[model samples]
Target chain A: EDQVTQSPEALRLQEGESSSLNCSYTVSGLRGLFWYRQDPGKGPEFLFTLYSAGEEKEKERLKATLTKKESFLHITAPKPEDSATYLCAVLSNQGGKLIFGQGTELSVKP
Target chain B: EAGVAQSPRYKIIEKRQSVAFWCNPISGHATLYWYQQILGQGPKLLIQFQNNGVVDDSQLPKDRFSAERLKGVDSTLKIQPAKLEDSAVYLCASSLTQGRFYNEQFFGPGTRLTVL
Candidate 1:
């Protein structure tokens, strides 16, 4: 069975605080790992895709690193505008379908 | 280019009623997907289509759910005799192709269905 689990179901961070969200997965054959940010009342926006272990990707204030069994989305000095639910998904080679985590709800208070 | 588009941002209905949602994927995208996202959970793929052909529908509940991608452009997902557990956000996404790598799906705003 392929499963993805995200930890720290909810996190409240003050503005300019840094934190990391975790996504662990168990899949038959890993193809890719994806990170997305979803805001209230809007669809999810693509963040990054890590294709292999030891791979890392970064955006303005976000960085994502991958390992053999898990991935981490590190937010550096996040701002209130950066608050959103971060989603993690893994694409398995067997079905070519993305198995998603429950997501981590992040709220940055100003 | 416009992103994926979904219709009826929100809908409220009684159980056992029928409803349908529509999706228009990004122009020229070869792959389309429909997902169900319950509150507090990530989106779950219900079906996948590649140029009007069903690539995957293993997760879709065929007893009450049916989807069609006619003309390889616009798609529709219908739920007949909806159940209370069917209340969730129906999201549509698209990608350039279903390649093994570099397949990033772009999502739509989604249609929120509330069944009572």
Candidate 2:
């Protein structure tokens, strides 16, 4: 069965603290790995998509990288505004579906 | 383009009561999805539709949960005789292609359903 597992179920980071959230997966075939940001009482917003290993994309303070067995979302000098539940999902060709990880709840303290 | 749209931001009902949630995906999106998000967990896909046809519903509780995307544009999900376990945020999302590229999925403000 395809599954996604995110590390540090919950994390607390002080302002300007840098960290990386891990999303490891086991699936038949990897189509894409997605990253999203979700605030409390709101839906998720698209963050980044990594298609293959060694591929990386950046936006402001966030960066995403992917490999055959895992993906990582790295935050550089994050602030309180970056606090939210970061979700990682794996798109599988086996069933044309996305299996999500439980997510890493990030708390950026000021 | 306008993002996905959902209605009844909040709904509270007693167990066994029937409740429905609606969704309107992007203008030209061919794929629509419904997900159930239990508190403190990731969104779990309940059903998926590709142009009004059921593509994947393996996780849907068909016995009481039903969904349809008439005309392949807008959709609705209904839970009849709801159970306490059904209390969760029902989220709607959509993407341009049914399944091919790594298109990003757009989400809407979910409907919070509370079953008493």
Candidate 3:
């Protein structure tokens, strides 16, 4: 069965603190890996998509790297405004659907 | 361009009642998706539509859940005889196309449903 797991259900970081969130997956065949940011009372917004192992993408203070079995979202000098739930999803070659992880709830305090 | 749009940002109802949520995907998007997001969890795809055709509905609860995108632009998701477990945020997303590995989906503000 295809499954995605995100570690550290919640994290509290001080402003300007850098951290990494993990997203591990088991899929038949990896087509792509996606990262999204979701704020309270809103739907998730697209962040990045990694299509292969050793691939990486970045946007502002967020960087996402992918591997054969997992992906990592590294935050650099995160601000309070950057606080939001980060979600990871995998699209398998077997189907066109995306399998999502539980997500990591991040809180940045000033 | 305007993003995906959803209606009724919030709804509260009793168990066993019926409710419907609507979604309007971005202009020219060829694919639409409906997802259920429980608190503290990632969004789960309930159905996927490609130009008014059902590409996937395997995860949707057929007995109580039904969705339609008749015009290939606007879609509606209905839950009949809602269960307490049905309480969650209904999210709608759209992409330029489906079956492409690089397609990025854009989401809308979800409709929060609370069943008592």
Off by over 4 Å in 2: none
Question: Fnat of each prediction?
Answer: 0.97, 0.72, 0.97
Can you give the TM-score per candidate against the true fold? 0.98, 0.97, 0.98
Q: On residues A1-110, what C-alpha lDDT tens digit does candidate 3 reach at each position?
A: 78999988999999999999999999999988999999999899999999899999999999999999999999999999999999999988888888899999999999
List, for all models, the DockQ compared with the true complex: 0.94, 0.82, 0.93
Q: Which pairs of residues collide in model 1?
A: none
Report the candidate with higher DockQ, 2 versus 3.
3
lDDT string, candidate 3, B1-116, tens digits:
99999998999999999999999999999999999999888899999999999999999999999999988999999999999999999999999986644589999999999999
Q: After superposition, how far is residue B17 of candidate 3 from its true place, in Å?
A: 0.8
TM-score, B chain, candidate 1?
0.97
lDDT of 1 by residue, A1-110 (tens): 98999999999999998999999999998888999999998889999989899999999999999999999999999999998999999988887888899999999999
Which model is ahead, 1 or 2, in terms of TM-score? 1
- For candidate 1, what's the TM-score of chain A, rounded to 2 decimals? 0.98
TM-score of 3: 0.98
